[model samples]
Target: MGKALDNVYKHQSLAYKYFLYLISVALIVFFFPKGGKFKYEFQKGKPWQYENLYAPIDFSIKKSQEEIAQEQLSIRNSKTDYYTFDGSIVTTVKNDVQKGLEQWFATNTFTARQQRDALKIGMDVIDNIYSLGVFENHPGSNSIIVVRNNEAVPVAPSDFLDLESAKRRVSAELSHSAIENRIGLESVIQTSLRINLFYDEALTESALEQELSRISYTRGEVSQGRLIIAKGEVVEAENFKILNSLKEEYESELWRGNNYYYIILGYTILVALVLIMLFLFLKRYRNEIFKNNNKVTFIFFNILLMVLATTLMVKNNESYVYGVPLCILPLVLKNFFDARLGLFVHVLTVLILGFVVPNSFEYIFLQTIAGIVTILTASELYKRANLFISVGQITLIYIIGYFAFHAIHEGNLENIEWILFGVFVLNGLLTLFAQPLIYMFEKLFGLISDVSLLELSDTNSKLLKELSDKAPGTFHHSLQVANLAEAAANEIGANAMLVRVGALYHDVGKMEKPTFFTENQVTNVNPHDDLPPRESAKIIIDHVIQGIEIARRNNLPDRIIDFIRTHHGTTLVYYFYKKQQEMEAEVDENDFRYPGPIPFSKETAILMMSDAVEAASKSLKNPTFLVIDEFVEKIVKGQMQANQFLNANITLKEIEMVKKVLKQKLTNIYHLRVEYPE
Candidate 1:
């Protein structure tokens, strides 16, 4: 048991990698829909590509969403409007009209017979208005169903009297009356009339909903063994509907009982395969990232994020699936890593999403093309304008790709969904968040990107300004080395920005004792002359060590610190060491050497070569092109022989390229112009 535990502890990293793979696969598969996938692909106005298909079992042909919506709308338009008739209101209005007419007659000098006739006429008008059913307001329907005495009866809207119509009726009836002061009697009747018909919103809505529910979502049925479509047949409107119904039914019925577990297993295997491909890709091509668990986690986490987002969108509403900023994946990865890895991971993510999204072929094609555009166009993420243009281009590609697919499916440009264009534009805008997200990832995962590198490369920064003030000559030397290193890195297709930033801070340790170095010696008094050779060597070698401490104090990223540690790479301080050897019989070499882990990447290796050649080129007297060439070649070749770049992932060919860049840059610095003879 102890041996087993020890073995587990020894291989913990390997076990952790497998655990990441397992968890990623589990999460992706868990989010995937449990429905079985249909084997056949079909589209309206396109030829069926598969063999002849027949119904395997009896299934009802379900109506399309458009058809169902049309049916529901028709039901709404043809629904019966319901209104409740208040008989009690009519009786109350009659009594109020009688009392109003009697009071008016009492106030004026009217004969008893005249008062009796006026009260009878006013009550008659009120009764007539109420019989026609005075409405509170127009119901906005030509016909209505009136509920009275617990029975609903059809009634014409014209039969109901609104306030204006009721007033008109009262005026017309009073004008024919023989009673004196007919206008007074008419006013009393109008004042007493009230609305007796009220719209029943609840009843109307319930009735409409009932009618809509009765709509037949399934128009017909296809029997078992019926031929649905033949190979190479054009999928017309009817054929497309039938095929979709069959697909829906088949997928829904396929995953039942034990088949559910099999579907889950199938999903697991496919997810595992895709993840395995990603792992193999990292292991083979991006071994550095594969070795680092944090980097691996970052990559997988991005994939999982996109998958979760896409699955949620599809589940809630598939129409808005394009609104998700999937292209952000490649953009973020390219900024943090390289374009190749970014594009590769983007393709794998889109492919995984294709398994769940509708129209797998079109989805995969559109996303894959968008990923390519993201990688190809997005450069210098630190620059806001570059990212904006790339996102615009990416959005335009989505629009065009979707347009083309739409045109193909419908066989024309008509009926194209214009809302999806807005979604694509929104997608582009969301992609701009990749910059901030990259900053967050850097903080969370302890990684660096070009954006941060650009910030670090600024000479006006606090640390860099301090370095320039304290060690002006060393700062200028670092500038020259930066230019040379940047040019070399660009020529060899390495990270030029990273190398330039590293070059800027490589000699920051010299700021501690600036005058001890010759470049900072303004006068001919050498400070090293007063100190012993061994002590001088110690001072010189301590710069690399001091730079690291200073960097840590300033919170510089580890990537930048790597350059400071490896710039000297254990090379001996030859001037001090040789002087000591002449004085003593023997001297220890280790005391004169700089502590180093050496350069381990292309950027660090370029900085080492650039630093050594730029510092040495200062010693040349009246240099020419040939002298500079031999000088640069000798320095780089010596470093190569001493195995300065043995651990770095660099080649001899690249080393020669770096030497050439140094020679040319030095020549240019000294103004080596060609002479034209007359």
Candidate 2:
């Protein structure tokens, strides 16, 4: 068990650990909630009640009881007693009938008391008319009609047809109607006073005129509370205005606050926070792998790409459609990491991003399947120029994924055609255009990109040119080392470009003192030939530090500089150390070693192994494929046993694969073969 655990740790690298940490951060942010819930309710009534003044009321009156006992019962069955009067007289006659009539006329006609009593009665009639349903009540105005001697007179609204006005109008009506007995015609005349009753509210002049034209019974004239008529009669207006007013009141009540304003604001904040959290987590995770250089710009580009995808997803989510083409990301990762780890992480990222997007389960499943296919297809195939072939290959995977997804879901084939066509276009775009798009985005936003691996392939890089000019043999050796490193990285499904780049610059310090390095010794004379073995060891050991300084001075990337500094792995300078021991010289083993923290990352580890293997293989006089195989296996195994690759993420199986690939590459570089009979 201990051995097994040790083996596991042996294969782990810092790069891999940082990669996992990034994923963990993404998971943490995706689940954070940003909004709280609240209960909502709507009320049904106004805060205040209004009185309805136009309610219906009966206006009929009944006969009085004294009339029925008098024996001359003419009128009956009135709803009100005041509506009828009895017809009998109890007074005795005078000796001359004309003299008696003259005397009765003198007693009642034109007298101050009699006129006052008549005017009082007219005013009472006007008040009663207003109380009847004929007149409607307005909140601020009341209506009345004026009459004088049974005739309605024209008057201004301000002129109340008070008792005086009523008497004048009634007397004028009586003169016009020519009624002989005032008492006998009182009931008939009062009926005339009730001529045309309508809404008796005091309206504006124009409104009053308009309303007056609509009434057909009596001519309406303006008075204190009513219209005066030529005849003393009133009619009631129909009531419905109360309900109309009530409906208007209710409508106003309903137009109060909607509460949706607060709801919208709350929802906006919640959605924004959730989206921001998602972006923050993803950006942080990417930063763990990419470090902080150009971080915001890289994050901006990724977010823009994600936003575009999210927009498409939202537009098509309802249709169960997703538009991200094949597993281009997995190919990218595999081109950048171990095939197995790349596949696992790519699938995870796809699943998580699917949730972030508004896509259905079908999209998630299809993307996973397509991503697996692309990664598997490109796993161990690491020719940088051939990266595009993986795109076409992924396109085929996309077609299969799209059709299979729709077919399983029982979607209509005809409707699926447009989506399939769109998928094709998206595939072409992601494959052929992703790099250019990333490059453009980098320029626009000042982003640094991981997409352009081939830039590391520049043979005319400053360090390479420096090596070529100062130490031609070392330059040639660096090229061979690059070939071996690239092959090993390809075999393990790692970044061949990164490995190749590192290999090309690893021994750059040897250029500073070309004679001290065996590879650059052109005159068959070694600088160590004159120097003591300990001094020669110190020179070799210092070269790693010198290389690092030179690399930093030129502002090379950390990735390239790391390879230059760590490619030696603190191993003892065996030749120099052994010679010192033969001379019985006491020296510290550390003093005869190259100073190194070891190859801490997969790219650096691969660089160191390939450099050692390629340089050591050159000593064989008659190198064969088997000889090259043994040499590579020995170099890799020695490094593994010495714990040089202890913390690196390169797995045991991957190490074996690297060894096999290195052997093949070295055989090719050396043209190793058995000389056959010909």
My TM-score estimates for the predictions, one after another, are: 0.95, 0.48
When superposed on Cα atoms, how far off is each prediction in RMSD? 2.2, 25.3
**Runs in model 1 lying further than 4 Å from the true structure:** 1-10, 107-114, 174-181, 530-532, 583-587, 673-678
Best by TM-score: 1
Q: Cα lDDT for residue 669, model 2?
A: 73
lDDT of 1 at 657: 83
**Model 1 vs. true fold: TM:** 0.95
Can you write out model 1's per-residue Cα lDDT over 1-678, one digit (the tens) per residue?
Answer: 999999999998789999999999999998987799998877788899988898999999999899899988877777787889899998898888878877887789998888877777777777777764877787677668888889988878667678888889889878887888777888888888788888899999998888887889898899999999999999998998898899999899988888899889988998899999999999999898898889999999999999999999998999999999999999989988899999999999998998899999899999999999999999998889999999999999999998899888888999888899999999999999998999999999888998899889999999999999999999999999999999999989899999999999999999999999888888999999999999999999999999999998999998899999999897889999999999998899998988888788999999988999889888999899889988988888887887888888898898888888888889889999988898
lDDT of each: 0.90, 0.55
Candidate 2: Cα lDDT at 670: 76
Candidate number achieving the greatest lDDT relative to the actual structure:
1
- What range of 10 consecutive residues in model 1 has the weakest lDDT sum? 123-132
Model 2 misplacement above 4 A: 1-335, 338-359, 373-433, 437-453, 487-495, 529-533, 581-585, 601-606, 617-641, 649-678
